[model samples]
Target: MKIALIAHDKKKEELLDFVSKHKDVFSQHELFATGTTGLRVNERTELPIHRFKSGPLGGDQEIGARIANQELDAVFFFRDPLTAQPHEPDVSALIRLGDVYRIPMATNIGMAQILIHAIRRNEF
Candidate 1:
């Protein structure tokens, strides 16, 4: 499965921790992420990840394209809803694409936990 790991600035640490916790499972799949988030996850977890541009610089759209192409199986996007993002429209478009494509997406820790387990169980 091809999994995308993305997070807003405020939620990067949380996503990193989640990745770390599930390194064994994640190691079995291909991983992709936005620039800074990818770098941080790779550095901390030693997981090989394909890195795209920063989100504000078009990373979300890049991932969305992959979704549209049926190249991505799941998305773990840890969004920071409380903060205002300069690339808000891009983010919305990405989420919209996910829904339109019927791609499973996790936008928070709770949803992520469920999705990760489902992946682990080979349920999707």
Candidate 2:
């Protein structure tokens, strides 16, 4: 399974922790992430991840393209809904693409936990 891991600035740590908690499952699949998130996740978990531009700099679009191309199986996007975002449209577009493609998407940690378990069991 190819999964994209994404998070807003305020949610990066939470996403990182979630990924770490599920490293065994995640390590079995291909991982993709935006620039800083990828870098930090790699540094902490040492998981090989394909990195793209930062979200504000087009990473969301890059991942959205992957979704459109069927290059991604699932998405774990830990969005910070409370805070205003500069790239709101891009974020919305990414989520919309996920929905359009019927790809599994987890926008919060609780949902992410379910997705991670499904991944572990090869449910997706």
* Best-matching candidate per lDDT: 1
Residue 5 miss distance in model 1 (angstroms): 0.8
- Backbone clash tally (model 1): 0
Rate residue 49 of model 1 by lDDT: 100
Q: On a 0 to 100 scale, what is the lDDT of residue 85 in model 2?
A: 95
Residue 82 error, candidate 2, Å: 0.4
What is the alpha-carbon lDDT for the whole of candidate 2?
0.95
lDDT of 1: 0.98
Candidate 1 error regions (>4 Å): none
Error of 1 at 107 (Å): 0.1
Give stretches of model 2 more than 4 Å off.
Answer: none
Residue range 1-124, candidate 2, lDDT tens digits: 8999999999999999998999999899899999999999999999999999999999999999999999999999999999999999999999999999999999999999888888888787
Q: Residues 1-124, candidate 1, lDDT per residue (tens digit)?
A: 9999999999999999999999999999999999999999999999999999999999999999999999999999999999999999999999999999999999999999999999999998
User: All candidates' lDDT scores?
Assistant: 0.98, 0.95
lDDT of 1 at 52: 100
